[model samples]
Target chain A: DAGVTQSPTHLIKTRGQHVTLRCSPISGHKSVSWYQQVLGQGPQFIFQYYEKEERGRGNFPDRFSARQFPNYSSELNVNALLLGDSALYLCASSADSFSYNSPLHFGNGTRLTVT
Target chain B: QQQVKQSPQSLIVQKGGISIINCAYENTAFDYFPWYQQFPGKGPALLIAIRPDVSEKKEGRFTISFNKSAKQFSLHIMDSQPGDSATYFCAAEDDKIIFGKGTRLHILP
Candidate 1:
């Protein structure tokens, strides 16, 4: 089976601009989460969506937002991007929302470079 | 405060030797612990995982040792190889996952 897939493998944006990253979860998966990994750092959660509803959010600012489609695909939108926003955006998906043992499968990630 | 703290930003080990990485978490509620391995230009993939209920879990050459009382966990790679060189991240999951800063492991041939 195909793992999680993300679109526009790479992206470039300017300060104050906006960017949208897309993710398609594996078949039969109902939950997707977004994370940003900066150089030399671990991923920081941005948002999570399951069954078309917001399940959880991280400490990111309002500038970061996300939505899940009925098909379980997800999109992350970053508004007024800052240079600091340049990082690898990772998308991970799990089979269910509440399963304690649900292991997340991740996509290769979209590398965002904001100048 | 960082919810999870990982030590020794980087590690180097000779082939066939053992390489260990440590991490400690502050949230006692975190019952699930997992380790992820990532290569250059690729996202992290699950290496191994353990729950507080288990003291240690071994999958092939990788093992996760969990200390529930101390809220600390570690990963040990046995018979290290150049192929094992990558970045390793320790994570704790409660409602969601909190990841450590990550450790870069380089196994020399």
Candidate 2:
């Protein structure tokens, strides 16, 4: 089975611009989550969608938003991007929303560079 | 309370030696603890994980030692190899997953 897949492996955007990153979860997975990893740092949770509903959110600003489709694919959008937004955006999928026993399968991530 | 603290920031070990990484958490509600390994330009992959109920769990050359009393945990790599050199992260799961800053490990051959 394929692992979690993300689109636009690399992207470059200018400050104040908007960018959208996509993710397709593994087959049979129901929950999708987004995370941002800055250089030399671990990933920080952004948003988590389970069954198309927002189940959890992180400390990110209003500029960051995400939604999951019926097929379990997800899109992460960042508005008014800033240099601080340059980082790798990762998508992870799990079998359920409430169970920590289910390990998360992650994508290689989309490398976003804000100029 | 959601934070997971990990250290040291980086490490270097000789091949055939053991590599150890430590992490501590303040959230007692976190029932699941996992360790992830990542290479450059790649997403983190689960190395090994343990539950609060178990004091230790081992898989092949990887082992997770959990200390529920002190809210601390550590990862041990046996017979470390150069290929094991990468960034490792320790995370705790509650309502969400919280990760540590990450440790960069380099095993010299």
Chain B TM, per prediction: 0.98, 0.98
* Candidate 1 lDDT score at position B66: 90
- How high is the DockQ of candidate 1? 0.71
Task: Give the runs in model 2 whose Cα sits over 4 Å from its true position.
Answer: none
TM-score of chain A of each: 0.97, 0.98
* Model 2, span A19-38: residue lDDT tens: 99999999999999999999
Candidate 1, residue A114: the lDDT equals 95
**lDDT for position B77 in model 2:** 98
Write down the DockQ of candidate 2. Answer: 0.77
Segments in model 1 whose C-alpha atoms lie over 4 Å from true places: none
Clashing pairs in 2: none
